[model samples]
Target chain A: MTVKQLTLPELTEACVRLGVPGVGLWREPVRAYGTEAAAKLVHDAGLAVTTLCRGGFLTAIDPAARADALDDNRAAIDEAVTLGTDTLVLVSGGLPPGSRDLHGARERIADALAVLAPYAGERGVRLAIEPLHPMYASDRCVVSTLDQALDLAERFPVEQVGVVVDTYHLWWDDRAPAAIVRAGDRIHSFQLADWTTPLPAGVLNGRGLIGDGVIDLRAWRERVDAAGYQGPIEVELFNDTLWVRDGVELLTDVAERYVRHAL
Target chain B: MTVKQLTLPELTEACVRLGVPGVGLWREPVRAYGTEAAAKLVHDAGLAVTTLCRGGFLTAIDPAARADALDDNRAAIDEAVTLGTDTLVLVSGGLPPGSRDLHGARERIADALAVLAPYAGERGVRLAIEPLHPMYASDRCVVSTLDQALDLAERFPVEQVGVVVDTYHLWWDDRAPAAIVRAGDRIHSFQLADWTTPLPAGVLNGRGLIGDGVIDLRAWRERVDAAGYQGPIEVELFNDTLWVRDGVELLTDVAERYVRHAL
Candidate 1:
């Protein structure tokens, strides 16, 4: 829900009117609209802010960049608390520019978590480490597997930090089902986005909608359910093709697809 | 090298003149040049055929397709023996069309191996399962990690089956170093290719030349060496940008970069 279709306020209104009880949100839009105002809009409309989009990119090798990311993530956690969302999704940033140190980048994720976890716990927000697809391993997120995310999350209290189980990211891993089972109460957020091919230039916005691609979403849903995750399943399609569609129509179609394919 | 780079005879001449002891050949070019003639060209030049590019795509769900793949792989095994290469690299094909069955696809690789391993072992051609980068999981290859390849390889007798450790395909995995150590004698082939971002449209030709990107190639070499491997380090760059350059010049640059970065 970052750009393309509707504003955050508009999306909130649409979600509430459409009886979508829970809505996940990105930070910048909420910031632009004023976080308190955005929070009030969803809160008054009787919608729960399921999760704040992200709070971690703590893998930057640069001191200034690293400091900036931590500051922004702290603000994101505060915003999450303000919006009444218990979950704050963190996309651990990828290999820092011109750096081949994946291990170092991953260690930085742990270092940042050590600092942010207590702050997040204080705010009653769970840091949900979202493992992006392996394609994003070099640029977007180094956390490329559910097992890796789970390993990182287990280092902290489950209430303070947890792992995100997104079908688009984790479906390719054979160990994902078992990892999901092991996640148990550590599974703070579950997202559904199908894997589509001929990934566009940059490969970032090529995700398919719930039933549009080959992922067995119902199987993933069942796996998560078996792990004791009784939460709103979010349909998070970041496709350039789907971005052009009318928001209401897209939401309606996705809601129906979610029922048929993901449930 | 594939056809985009060199004619077999010309590549053999370049290898001989450049003092490069071995060269990897692809199936299509070998078939085109006549496997016997391609064998003669490299053999006469005293160049060891490090590996035949590929021999498996056995994940096709169609019975006919699967049978054809096995038959073709058998032919590839014969070709590998003719070319005097012990390794026949297997890029395990991706999910069958319109299917999300990665586990099933992977199982097909094992099934195919059960048939091909004995066939290969008899001919002294070890089946090397090469895991392509996970970006290829949807369409190109399902085996996307060293451990996944190792899992399949470990199922077969060590002499008949083994794993390929490619730095480009494997560097991002936090477990890759340990996987390489665990690979031990099972590592049949080791390749060096750097990962460059802003991955082009198809993403196939987006590989960076060894030193030009951020993969710690020397580290991977050390890991493989620690695992008791002292083999030809094939510098397999698939960059469209590098492809258009003069073959001799590209080879020279790659050789120099390989020494500087990968050794």
Candidate 2:
């Protein structure tokens, strides 16, 4: 697989060649290859679809747009179902445009979840609310802690809604271990990545490849395992450096490091 | 105050002339004026010393440097006592150099506080641990929420330790009001400022002058007041724009807005 550009076919081949058991697929990449074609490529390669990267962007200044988000999330659930991925990650969106009302945004998230959970349950997909880092509070996700994600999980049936515990977003959280224990079976996904030193131009580029930066991934694995979640732990790195490398090289490094440092 | 080429004496005189009641004096300015001379000037003017801007930088890679931090904090406490400021604001430093052990650094902070608390109490000064925003978690302060500050405060005597609830750091917290209520008498100081759009330089230049940004100051004042804190809510703006303006003009505008929108 080449680093300069990655097609669904190349990504699937890379995953198989690098021996990564599973991969977290972003929506744009899936859309690029067409969902059916992407699903067939991964399935043909015998690669597990750990999760679909996102579903929720519920914050909207207009009620119509808010309703539209729920409809869109239902479509995402269908996509997850088609991909044979049970977990659909949701990033509860930030405050409405020009609005500083964080509380109101939270309420909107709750409302969106209430609408989306039923459809996800019917589709046999578990909706995982991923608590982003607090840095994203202004323009990304309002859910910024595992405790907050657990709180949201409590509002829905256990089989329908859960939480994605990402090390990159939560490694600094003092309450992470306790929150993981509290999540128990509701912890649907355990995602890993490292926090880089210098934040890139977009802040998103600052995510480090697993084992590249400082994160207690072994401890996290023990915690999640102890909490009764035996699901595939996805390594989702968004590093510009890694992204520019040959896909085979990147995947091989990640797989080796994941086994040595994370698994 | 004149924006250009001002000596410490000139800066101090400008603060007094601006009718700001008290300034949140930093160590650099204190060092520039000589701590004793600065104290004498405040004493001579009969101006109240509201709070010292900082004390804690307890995280260091070298054990000797960490000990040095404790010693320096002791000196800061003595300076606060000499200045007649009841509250010494502590900005808990971030992860020690070359270490990703956040939990270990937190333990060191607790240990330092335990050693410093009794000495601070003896000097008739309270240590106010200010929890900065989470964005500064890596390089600035580990304490990043009001709830975390309250958790730390629970370890010390109410008279010796408390929290500085700054709106700039906490406006995004969903549990801020409840945490404020929980802090109650442990709330040593209430600081005001506004959150502006386009955070400048992504750090120091981002703070907005009161009423110029999006914080609901009146609601915050009501909540803090309801929590039974009768202390004067101080206006602490760290804006580059405000720093460039005439100190008299800045203070007048702040005072008028504080009364009109906050009180």
Candidate 3:
């Protein structure tokens, strides 16, 4: 959500002006702006819809909740199709409320993927499992490492499921480079969000502007390139500090940061 | 630092009164109380000094800084010996100032351990590598997983170096259970702190007291038990909310929670 302050049309317009070829759209804003209209806007502007933000909070113990999640995921897959983005990022949900069974919770994610992966595959949309940082393992997503994401995704066909290599989430992991190699063509989407210290309260919106943090963004880009991931390198930041600024200005900054640090 | 409000003597007294056999000591407070005096107080009170809180921060890029870290670690080992504790927990430091090389930082920790481990071992103490949570990997410790800690500790003799499986830091890792098994006798210390949501600002003092959040403490205890760890199960919380309460009352609450959730 780097330029979350911009409207869909404004985002597409900025991308075109900034020469940012592809735009990754979050589901909420897309739905709010009319998905078909958003698809048309980006399409008409000659920009690729790189990915649909999310769809997987499937770690529910309640059967009804599980059904709801599956339905939501199916809807997300449909949205991806409409947006013409083959990649649907799945943030596998955290442990169900008051449940200490992380294993069971992960298994539930696998179960949901079993139902959704093929549905996604049939529609030419791949489920991209984005393993968030372990700090987010409680309420955000239990998938906390590249290896864990690979373990889950490897069970499905390469065409059906894959992983997102986000620098912010996986930079602390020493083995992530090796895991990236293993991910190979299964690296569906590569995202960039640098890690900044003293994470903001709620720990949700502290993502750094690329070069502002310690991550070797270029090094990660090289590794992902070596892994045969010929995908769009999307800058997906959730930063409060940047959000308050003008959206177009932030987008310009992001484009400059990406070229300077991530290129 | 669950019962940090309690003085050394007060902590020892509470342990005795509550039939708690052992207490872990942090370096600063013990140094403040006089290391020898603190040792005598705990020993005279019939309590075991389970461990010394820490001795790390070896990821300095400057040679003089690295040398200082080593000298400080040497003193920590000395303090652990004086306290009659065989374990000195190490919170291996994070990135050196502007450095983006996590591998280099981790190598620095290894370099520090090479010097300190044997020194501690000679004095009947083991350097326990406590992998802080990945959230702390930026400023606190680069060793963010038990597997990473084991990777470092295994380079030294088990008597000289080992890993600390702190629930708060490790419970999020899907592979931690298997890593615990792999650790076997290299597991030096076991600590408890639960995972709570909407982490507080700064993110350093939000660790939950046992049973207050999402960790399966009893299961972790059982896993470590199965892995042949016979050490004291230390309840270490760095919660700001709990620190304001009465020390004795907090100790009682911790003891109750430990028995209920961690036993």
Candidate 4:
């Protein structure tokens, strides 16, 4: 089954056809097609929404702007609720402009989460903190390791807060396997992607499509499985080159790679 | 003193004049003047050579080429020995090209060290494994944390194996203080620099000139001092902007910043 091109509808349908149990959808697509419409499309296609791509950027210079982010995250929780996506992944924002204090920015993220967690809980959406790669430590995400994420999680109840363990971010971590075991059932989602060469812009464009880069996907999967996480493993690639290609072709390649390597 | 501009000679003389303690000299400068001449120049100027800026790239596809790296490192150790420097800093090379196995590459680094350690020891040069920031994990250095460096060091005697604790690579680490303590006397050298906003290349060229960036230099110095390391703290800045300025001006600025913020 070679997929060539796919829109949201076709992508959803193809997941079912390919026997993929769930799909992790990003915010742009959800916003573009309208959350309700996308939800209906997924439901009609008999596909489960595994996780929402993100909902956090709580670091900002302006207090009002930070509050605005919180409000927007509340809206994201509502959208996740409407889509029946239980996990809302949060990529904590980095330090604001004219500020080099990462520790302070982290505190702000925790404070914002303290406010948003209750709102997310009210909507039955679990807040899953995704610790991005340390490369993103300055400008993108302050939380850069699973241990750091787990440390943050300790501050909240397991039912209200969990963590998204993406292999791309945590694979190089020396304590990764142990951290996963420590996370146990609190591992809200497992994201799969390989580390590619020449990280573009050192941030956004460098994610490798599964099985294409250096990550030992099988080892990561085995560790996660051993940690007792029975949740769906979502293959999330942020490759600009792949996105430029046909979506169906990309999806087909992703599915095939998953079968051969990830599964 | 408000340092604005001064020549390289003036910079070198100032180190002597002020009894600046230690300086990590780059290869180009030393090579241009020739190793013997450069050693005499520094000795005449009464300066202490702390550590050579680098010596590692052992991960190469060809075995002969990889062996060449050890040869180069041997030359560097000779240079360090001639200059009266005891510690030779090693930035463990990243994964080889067309390779995805980071663990394999790390093993290759350990192997390289095992081959070179005896020669370095004979020359009375201690190899200090400087774990670069995790951002350099792919193209530069695989050792990304103090703990990782410590793990590598445990394989050898403390006098033979040491770690360079650079603030830029380690400030974000939650276990930094503990790692510093664990490092104890094996902490070969201490390097200081700040992490500024708007990171250039998302990794390189973003280091702050001491007080200009967000790191708590004084606090870090206190931690290292408390750990019983009374060595000279070298200020290593990879800032292109700073390099474009007069060398003497940069040195004076560094001295003032060290006294004001780092001491």
Candidate 5:
């Protein structure tokens, strides 16, 4: 959500003018702009829809909540299909309210994927399990390592379920490089969000601009390329600092940073 | 540092009155109180000296800074010996200034240990590598996982080098339980701190009181016990809220929480 300030039409127009080839769309903004119109705008502008933002928060303990999550995921899969993107990135939800059963929560994610993966496969959408940084493990996602995500994804068909390798989340992990290699062709979506220090309160929106942090972005790019990932390398940042800037300027800056740092 | 509010003397007196068996001492306070004097105070009060707070920041790039870290660690080893504690917990420092080499930083820690482990062992003290949480990977400690700590610790004799199992730092990792089992007798010190949400600004001092947050402290204690760790289970909390409370009351609460939540 690096340039979240941009409306879908404005984003698509800017992308076309800037020679950007694809745009990954988050559900909220796409839903707000009407997903069909949003998809058409990007398609008419000759830009690919890289990946849908999300599809999973499947750790709800209540039966009703679980059913609602499943329905929401099914809708997400349909939206991905409508957007003509085969990948739906899943920030699998964290532990239920007061529960400390990490294993149980993770198992629940697997159960949700068991039902949703086949449905997504039928619709030509692969659920990309995004293992968020461990700082977010308590309230965001139980899957904190690429190894763990691969463990969960390997249980399902590689065509149905895969992993999203985000540098911000996985850079601290020494095992992640090897895990990325092991992920190989199952790497559905590759994302870049730099990690910066003295994280702002809540630690959710402190993602750095591409070149502002300490990550070896180009190294990550080369690693994923070597791992047989031929997917779009999306810059998916959640930064409060960048969001306040002009959307077109931020998008241009992001494009420049991607080429200079990530490419 | 659950009862950091208590002075060294007050801490020993309170521990004695509360039937607490031992206490872990931080170098700063012990230095302020005079290491020998602090040791005598705890011993005279019939309390065991559990473990020393820290000794490692060995990732400095500059020659002068690296030398200072080694000297300081040597002092810490000496202090641990004087305090009659066999364990000196090491929080290996993070990446050096402006550096993105996490692997290199970790290797520097190994290099430092290669120099200091034997020094501490010669003085009848074992260096306990405490892996700080991954959130601190950028600026605090590069050792972000128990397995990583074990990887470093296993390079030396078990009597000379070992790992600390802290609930707050390791509870997010699914692989930690297995790593603890793998650690076996190399588990030097077992610490208890809970995982709470909406982490504070810097994310350093937000460690929850023993029973206040999401971690299953007793389960960790039991796991370490199963791994053959028969050592002090120190409650180390860095909460700003707890620090402002009455020291005696906080100490009493921590003791009660230890029994109720971590025993």
Candidate 6:
């Protein structure tokens, strides 16, 4: 939700001026800029749209909401295709309100993927299922581990449904390292952010700059490399403190930490 | 950290007055009250010390700190025996500051447990390893799931080391229900607290009253009971908001929620 005011043209120009190679576009801003224009802006600057910010929440218990989620996700896939991004990140929704059926919610995510994976595969767009941190397992996303994501991913073709490895969401999990290795080529997108303490209220915008938190970025990077993942490593930080700073400065800060901690 | 003000006598008296069968005792307050005196207070009041909180931080990398942890844990075991509690809660500490070796930290816990188990076993105390939520995996505890806690507990005799089934920590995990059944007789202590979102600044004081949040405490209680755990189902809530209130009213509230939600 950072950079809410920055225009698409300004962001793309800043990327070019700052020598940043690529950018991840969210559905809201890309749609605001017109997906085709956003695609052209990044492409004209010779930058890659690393991954589109989302399309899941397909675990709704309401019949109407479930159908809407499917339609919305299909639309999100079309937008990803238009933006020239192969990765459409899916944050599967959490348990329905007042329901503690975690098993049922997880099953809904898997079933949603079974339907959407084929839709994405035909368009050459991959559905990258992102396992959010366990803290968000109730309200945000129920897919809370790489192991869980891979378990769901393995159910589909490797080219269609894949897992996303984000340090901020997964660094705390001891199983993450082995899961990264086991993921192999199923890792659709790799993102970097750090985990900091005293997580803010809502706990959404507390992601730290790479070296500022406790994540072993270098170790995770090495493990991913060992897995033969030759993909773009996106430095995606959703930080409250950094969001208030100049976007260009934040980008520079991320790039600097990328070299210092994650190389 | 809740209920920091009430003295041991006052706490035990409150328990007796409120018809509360038992209370969870922390090491700091118990030590402050003089373990023998505190034990006598609870024992005379016919109150069971459900669990003595905690005796860990055994993940130290330095030799001296590690040795100190072991010594402290040994003393903690002796205190639990004095307090008339068979269960000694152990919150395995997180990564050593500035160290990202999660695997190393976990192994250190196992090593510490291997040493502590036999010592505890001799004294008729069970080391109940509590897997905190993953949000606390950095600074508080490396063990973050029932499965992981069981993996560590299985290495020792069931009488020497067992797992604590706390709803606040394990509710979000989809595998938790099965892990409960898998734990079977090794479930030493079962605690209840609900998972609430917008987790406080440090994410420590966010545990909700039994039914105040999203956890299916009744279901968890059922699962633990099904696992053949006929032990004290401790209602442990660590809410900052509740701590400032009158202890009697809070105890009354907890007692009410325990029946409506946990029973």
Pick by DockQ: which candidate is best? 3
Q: Which regions of candidate 2 are displaced past 4 Å?
A: A1-5, B1-18, B43-46, B196-205, B211-214, B237-261
Full candidate order by lDDT, most accurate first: 5, 3, 6, 1, 4, 2
Cα lDDT tens digits for candidate 6, B167-260: 8898878788999888999999998888887688878888887787888888888899888889988887788888899877777777887888
lDDT of 6 by residue, A1-263 (tens): 33444678878887788787888889988887788988988999999988998999988989999999999999999999998989999999988888788878989988888889999999999999999999998999989999999989999999999999999888877678899989999999998888888788889888888898888888888888999898899887777788788876777677777888988
DockQ for candidate 6: 0.75
lDDT of 2 at B76: 92
| Per-candidate DockQ vs. reference | 0.71, 0.37, 0.87, 0.37, 0.87, 0.75
Give the per-residue lDDT of model 4 (tens digit) for A166-214: 9889877778789999999889999888886666644576678887777
TM-score of each: 0.96, 0.91, 0.98, 0.89, 0.98, 0.95
Model 3 CA lDDT for position A92: 94
- Greater lDDT among 1 and 2 belongs to 1
Candidate 4, which segments miss by more than 4 Å at Cα? A1-7, A13-21, A59-66, A96-108, B1-11, B14-21, B59-66
Q: Write the per-residue lDDT of candidate 1 for residues A168-197, one digit (tens) a residue.
A: 888878888989988999999989988888
What is candidate 3's local distance difference test score?
0.92
Q: Write the per-residue lDDT of candidate 1 for residues B1-263, one digit (tens) a residue.
A: 52257788778887788788898888888899999998988888898999888988889989999889989999999999999999999989988878888888899899999999999999999999999888899888999988899889999999999999998898878888888888899999999888888899878888888887778888889889999998777988787888889998888777777778876
Checking candidate 2 for backbone clashes, the offending pairs are B1-B247
Candidates 3 and 6, the one with greater TM-score: 3
lDDT tens string, model 4, B35-136?
887787777777878788678887776889887998999988888888788998998888777776777787788888888888888888899999998778
Which 10-residue window of candidate 6 chain A scores lowest in summed lDDT? A1-10
Lowest summed lDDT over 10 consecutive residues: which window, candidate 5 chain A? A1-10
